[model samples]
Target chain A: MKLILLLFLGQVAPVEVRAFDTPYDAGGSITIIWEMDTAWVAKVSRIGIFRASAPGLQDSLIETLYKPDSVYVDNSAKDNVPYYYRIVVYSDDTLIAEGKTASAAVSTQQWFNGKRLSVLIILIIYTVFLLYFIMRARTNKNLYIRKIAGLEAIDEAVGRSTEMGRPIVYIMGLGYISDIPTVASLAILKRVAYKAAEYNAEVVVPCYDPIVMVAAQETVKEGFVEAGRPDLYKESDIYYLTSDQFGYAAGVDGIMMRQKPGAVFLQGYFYAESLILAETGHSIGAIQISGTTAVTQLPFFIASTDYTLIGEEMYAASAYLSRDALSLGTIKGEDYIKMILVVVILIGALMESAGIRILTDFFSIF
Target chain B: MTTIIWTWVAAFFTLAILSFLYKDNPLYKFAEHVYVGSSAAFTVLYVWVFDAYPKLVIGFKEKAGMQKYMLVIPLLLSLFIILRFIRPLSWLSRWSIAFTVGMAAGLGITGLTQGFLVPQVQASFLPLFVRGETVGQTVLLTMNNVIIVFGTIFTILYFYFSREHKGVLGVSSKVGVTILMLTFGASFGYTIMARISLLIGRIYFLLHNWLRLV
Candidate 1:
């Protein structure tokens, strides 16, 4: 089998490299093209574009383009400096062939200069505002924040689960642990674990990754210890259920049906399985509070879960949970930025409608 | 004949993904394991053949003149990763974790400044006036620009948290929240459309590309 695989790969022709015109009128970009051999093309999966300053430069790999096409455009290159590009063909992650270097020189154009300037100014103003608020918050000055009703309901959810003598099931979505939303999800889990510990309610966490399972177990253990219920902590409470997406979903669904937890906390990044889990939890009469940055899944959660935290709210879970002054201050700063955005949008709209160029011209100053 | 076989493979994958609607089964399990194993194996093989072997190994041989020594770093790293199976020496994996985290943080900070903060903020600013434009057109452009700028600013303000919300600042913050919520709603709508589009595209491919139904 291995010999056959090697011979098949050897028969595949190397990628062909050529320079071609980029799609857009933008002159600074150039496309690199290659051809796939017949056998390889039939089974070919994706092409990877490796870019560098010159050929044989090991440390200069700048980017990888993942696409099935034999061509890719280097759109972000600057004029005057030459760029060397290489292409690699892969089938299911196995490298089938490599292409030679194609060099391209970029030149700037005159079009879109006006639009670009306006964009630059607006970006500067908003950035300045963000930095100002961040500094203000950092200085520990008093910042007013509105109450989040969902946050207030956290205690109620835990207490209900406790009173009902049912477990509190917390499931982090399939988002990578490194993502901000996933971190925020873990922060919420920390709070939930603490509350559950205080209520003496069992907490079950079925994770999709071994790494996440480890982090969650540690966080839950710390939460229980802090709540003076360390004795209730069990390793099995936070267990690795397969890393497969739908498999994990199935395992979680089974747990929801059998354990029949009182409160189900769904936090983190979720995809299609979100609705399935929430609907199941809803059927079992569990009070479900869900938070995710996956906008596509938000509607499903909103329809099924009792309470939902939208977009940035998930990122603010730490602030809401800990009420840490710094985090809260950041939230307040974000609010100020939002307000400025609204006013600018309204004024821009009005000025455009009234045939007054001054408002827009003034805004262009940034 | 080959096309038919490929079509069958694709159809099988599509059905395997859709099978979750009914429940998990052996077919789904097989598909899932195949995806995971193939993806991981493919990643390793690609890195070896394309990245590691070409750039690091062969390039070093041609240019650096110390191919044998240069191969040591990656070899050791790969070895250490495999040692994760050993219970006691697992802590050695921290080196990889630290390296990954450090690189990610560095890249993130640089990207956040150039890709996000700079361009987004710059795009927000549009002069209140432009020369040689009609009054109505100018007004319309200005209003749109203002909304964009205002939205960007207040949204950032709404995230601030050093002080208490008691007075005029409180009102501004509330407005910020409203703008942010609207943005969220729009984003949510767009995302739903995007995912639905992907689903449609997949179904279209299954029908047209595979089954020839279309």
Candidate 2:
């Protein structure tokens, strides 16, 4: 049997094996690749991957592949550690041929992932555009920003609330203070709260988060101070409700029902409770303006609210309401970026249609 | 006996909450207050027990060297945030807030680019024309790709705030709005089904768990 096996093994060439640290990764992984004569492939029933700390040490089998797979990644390797690898080809239960790496491969943590180079490039370009547009906007104070109805109705909403002798309710939805939407909502809150203060109409804010409640209090205070009515700033009005989603909704609904506010501003991130709050506001006959980046809840806002800021519109609200040169420039820069993205998509689609995958490959090379 | 009492209590609260559909009254108010008050208290306890105790107290006990020292930064930042209550030292809280805001911005940019932008743009790069086994299959694939390509472009154009919606932009935006509305319609239906399922669950609980009717 040994003589017959030797003769059979001698007929096929040794498989070429290479082991190396996986690139563009944090670390702790090694990739092993093997190439063998195609003619000898049919005879191989399985391949086994074996690893060891050193060349002289006994290699322990890590994984076995039943099929003729050419590549395997060993994710169990330790970072900054050298590893020796061996690949064994087996016919049924018997080892027929084997290959080993010429030298040990060391898995090292990469300082930077080359895969994210494109994202970094895009970000740098966007920053440059934003800075340039901001400079331009400083000189040309008349930078054009298309009108947003939701933002425009702020004054009107406040005025109506004042006329009706009713309060204005501003509910920053279930978002942590760290959320960008919540930050954006704070900006809009400053403006709305300022208007309410000027009109001598109360702006009630029921917060979902304690941190957000504090932020809202500060924002509303600033708004009141700016409106020369610091005394009207009620810290008690902008209070934390409950952390629970449904509980927050119930709390807000109760506030809306009890206060019967003339205008309601639903802004920031919301979940399933979006519709509940919006519908309650609607039922109370409050003129509702809702804004969020939550795609799942936008339809609920649209169906229930008088004015809805969809997706990016909410992001643009701060700049739109403020009309500040720096903010407007950023918005313009973002719009230009959107245009570039559109052009890139069109070009990529065209290239893909022509069966030239250059553009597709460029985007896909993570 | 305790299980039966708890079930009865749960049933009472459920009925009280359901009564809000007809009109707001004392029962609904009682349930609402209970829910909010308990949830707030529960959340405080939950955070202290799960997040604060484990990550801070246990981490301090388990970690060593640089890892242990690393916990100090977060501890100090958290302490600074809590300092907002001190009127004279309130400005110190801004440092912690600034750190949070900066971190959020950095994470947002990287996350949007890596998670959404790159993958979305790559997936949108579909062959406009496909040659399949049959002419019908080929046509269908081609149409699908066309819709995807155009839909993405038009939808993006709709959100372009710099340019006023006019001419080609207007037409494209209109198409985009139509597609968005259609998507919203489908989403509405899907979400309603989920909400209905939740309602069904509640109904099942009332019958099976409480009344033993189902």
Candidate 3:
């Protein structure tokens, strides 16, 4: 049908149409290019574009475009379906020339986005360093991480709670079970729980997430089990209250107010509620040690809490607390990687100043 | 027809929650419970209405080729995660979690590198001094860039873990701590401003919207 229409309109005038698949895209796009014949320039006032899917029974008029608008991208093309495009010339609402794609075209998926090669390159660079460090870590178990003060204070805090004869309140902030900082918080929770068990101090953990509650229960149980105080581990101690941020904060604040717990462990992913929890713990005269990966909430924790694992130091804190060689090695590796990044940045800047485009351009995203 | 009644319901819940400022009580509990329960229900509703129906079901139906059929991958993965409900089959959920954690790590690397690292490095290449400009503007821009350049380097150095904090490196790390403290103060001020703004909105609602005393 498209052939017949084009042939019928060919006698009027021939307007050549070019259609090809768009490149460097994920899929589902085609570009159409056409030129208005110089001879037909005076004869035609405007032009139209139409596209039809396979088994073309009809044409869907896409646009009625004017002069100097000869290019269009048919991003509306579907994945599997072949698309045929046409250019129609209208001289005062009369069909003057019609040009259609000789063959049907389908958009194909590209293996890679060449435009984002720089991203892939940098990713490879980071991966190489990570792998190298991991390999080196297998050998270098002697690697040392600087002493994180917050972690060292964990024992002191737990001991203080034991001495005061008050329960230790450990609140895991409202983060999903899968959040990295939350996982790290749970590790530290285990450490604190073990210390509490050893000291025969009751450890009260109020969880925001039910999943985290179950996890924390298991963790604290393990801590007591490891401490050879299985009899002291009570399932009722670690309980789920509510997941709502404010509600959890209020619940924690209530615990802090009523018990005036000797030591409060505020750790994990907290948002606006960081200040609330820390401030409440402070008001209760509890020795608070807080850590969060949330950059925005750190200052509140710093201002209110006694010891803070600043930023990424929370991850290092877990390894530091555990005193695991593998974890220490990984932290050391990460430090080395940071140095590499620093060097790269400095070199890139110098190159930029020197008008040496090679280094800077190679790292350019676009 | 229900607009006035709806307003009353909202206002009641608002007051119930606000009452917590005095102390936790039954009203506060009622409001908090309602918030949690409704939020959970809304989450289910959203997954069904927006996500499950539109993205999964409709997409499966509308999708024509390999890409459309590939939707089964995530579907199967989700079903595996649902196995956690069955205690004996709970170990199967680990596969799903592994997939999620793996994808998150992969995507996080991409996001952190492109969204943060690259743009940050690119943005830091500001000129040390402005050429062919008035001294005031030149001095201001130069100083701004200078602080940014030094602060960025120093802050990163402060977080540097491998080296012992002694000598020249120690001095820079100290400077980094100072910069970080200044940044924390700025962050606190900004955050407090936002919180105060929210408080102002709540106060306005109590005065005009609910109490109608304005």
Q: Ranking by TM-score, best first? A: 2, 3, 1
* Share of true Cα-Cα contacts across chains kept by each model: 0.14, 0.70, 0.30
Candidate 1 regions exceeding 4 Å error are: A1-146, A241-259, A270-284, A293-304, A310-312, A323-366, B1-103, B129-135, B163-167, B194-214
Residue range B16-125, candidate 2, lDDT tens digits: 98888877889989999999999999999999999989999999999999999999988988888789889898867777777887898889988988789988988888
Candidate 1 structure quality by residue, lDDT tens digits, A216-275:
776798899999999999868997676567667766877786788999999999988898
TM-score for chain A, candidates 1 onward in order: 0.63, 0.91, 0.77
Candidate 3 lDDT, tens digit per residue, A1-366? 443464466566666788788878878888888876565666567878888885556878877777646788888887767878888887777777778553677888788877667778777766676677666667766566666789989999999999999999998898866687887887899999899999999999988876677678778988999999999998888887776677677667666767889999988999999998898788778899999988899999999999998878887776677756556665766777677767777776666666676666656665
Q: Rank order by lDDT, top first?
A: 2, 3, 1
Q: Using TM-score, give the best candidate's number.
A: 2
Clash statistics: count for each candidate: 106, 0, 0
lDDT over C-alpha atoms for residue A147 of model 1: 58
Please give the range of 10 consecutive residues that has the lowest summed lDDT in model 2 chain B. Answer: B89-98
How do the predictions measure up, each by TM-score? Answer: 0.57, 0.94, 0.77
- How well does candidate 1 match the true structure in TM-score terms? 0.57
Docking class of 2: medium
**Backbone clashes in model 2, listed as residue pairs:** none
